[model samples]
Target: MGTISPIKESTCCDPASAGTVYLPSGTSLILLMPRLLATTIHGAVDVLKKTFDGTYDDNCPACGETHAHGGICCGIPEIHCPSPCVCSIHWVGCPGDSFKHAIQVTNTSKTEREFTLTSVPFPHTQEAVAVTPGKQTLGTEESLQAEASFTIPETFAGSKYRTVIKVKGAYEQIIQVCLTVRPRQACGCHVEQGDIPKRVKAHHWYHHFQCVEDCFEPAKKVG
Candidate 1:
């Protein structure tokens, strides 16, 4: 008859939230682990809070509040900056005179705060969208303005020009200005000293230029 012997068994385990940790079962170590350790929330919730954050019905309600500022990421009482506002496009003109447009960037914060405008998508030449005055500081009940202008050239006498105006730091706001130049027909070759010229020249040139070297010759022979 074979003798029965006690078999050696391995240790046991209880999962943890942040990461896996070996704890001696039935000891004080089991009580110390957080309740959410085994769940997916333990491994990813903190990472979600760290990058590419946004707010809608249950998130921060403002811009730049997620990355720059710290907040608790929960299902309720969404996180966001205290103040939120936006700049927008107001007007666009067609070929009429010159390109011109304006904008008003406001501060919605009730408390005093400072902001520095750093733009990558500017309205001109695909350059860094930057504030005209540079390193601006706005307080409560304050605003900023910007404008664009372009003169009409003689060649494009009746042509239109478009000017894009975008606010710095505020990516959403954009404006396009249209300046229409009145039409100016070319000088009348027929008119001489402010007199009827093209009226008479066009008449002769149309047929005269077409007839070429033999224009008057053929008429002379017929006459």
Candidate 2:
């Protein structure tokens, strides 16, 4: 083997000077953020790879450390990229008419965010549901009040339905709403009382009235 050259002595003689650095375990901590780089390198070409990946010297102020791809053995802080809004609702709607309900979406972030509202009725039911202002954009600290409406079919009964509202921006979030529909019998003689419109008479029936014998009787024939 050829004679080894004398090692250079410098102010910083740590292994890091040879192009490799050792970061103690737990020294790197990432909190409340998503990783910009899905992978990291620890080989001879680590520096070259980081430069090519465009993640060099991108230090997070929260943790005061460069990203893993930036040559710091210590863990890099999460991107902590700001979100467009803070959602206010999880499950909306209570036991009531499935035809309509109120909704609220708020944008609490410092920037603008885009959102969309959609619905999925119970597969077995014939009702069609929809959300008003389905798609919209909100600015910082802005909010929107939307309505969800259901169009009940002829044979609908008391049932529950669900709708999924998705908010997409820096990240994606899903919101769910449960809707309750009352049975047609809930009208309770509204048809006879004229409380309901004449056009809608055939669509609804009173539960008590249905159990009774037919109101009309056939006339007897004369000899």
Candidate 3:
């Protein structure tokens, strides 16, 4: 038979401590050591706060506001600066006249934003293109319309040309504008000019070097 050992009083399970104590009558006993723990309401709250960051109803980290024009993502507010408010013009012409269009820019941010507009002219171009109010500042949720003009030179005779309009600053956008030159029909006549009386011929369905008396009219009148 095995002999049983008695438990020491000093080593007994204490009610103040967190542990389990068991006695096997006059046989054996088992004991489990207690584990210490320290926690407070403030500590628990901090843990919860870290777990649910940027949840709904929380302030935005980017703009430091509860709401923004664009929704929040990853605790950051969406910035909508220099967003284009205008649509691109595919083709513009007025038959020996100038073309003009309106371009709108919007600043959806909560603060002011700077903007600049410039044009990229193509090679072998004779017309002059420009933008009005090219550079300016915009306020929150504010918008501005810039006028774009393209003057067709009398010497312009190309079928079409493309110009790239660029807006730079807080935001950026590239708008492509295509301009077409009106075609001039053949007048089926000849013109004499210059010191030597240069003569110009009219090709089939094409304009002559010089304008004729009845170049573009209902009835043909040679002069």
Best by lDDT: 3
Across residues 85-130, which tens digit of lDDT does each residue of candidate 2 receive? 3333322223443456677778888989887765555567544457
Best by TM-score: 3
Task: Kindly state the number of residue pairs that clash in model 1.
Answer: 10
Candidate 2 — which residues are off by over 4 angstroms?
A: 1-98, 124-127, 182-223
Instruction: Name the regions of candidate 3 deviating beyond 4 angstroms.
Output: 1-86, 186-223
lDDT of 2: 0.57
lDDT of each: 0.44, 0.57, 0.66
TM-score per candidate: 0.29, 0.36, 0.42
As for candidate 2, its clashing pairs are none
lDDT of 3 by residue, 1-223 (tens): 9999998667675677667665555432222211112245566777777556633455566667775335655454467766463446665454567678888888888889898888877557544468998988999878878998876666655478776788886666787887776655431247774333334556666644554353244454557
> Candidate 2 versus the native: TM-score?
0.36
Candidate 1: C-alpha lDDT: 0.44
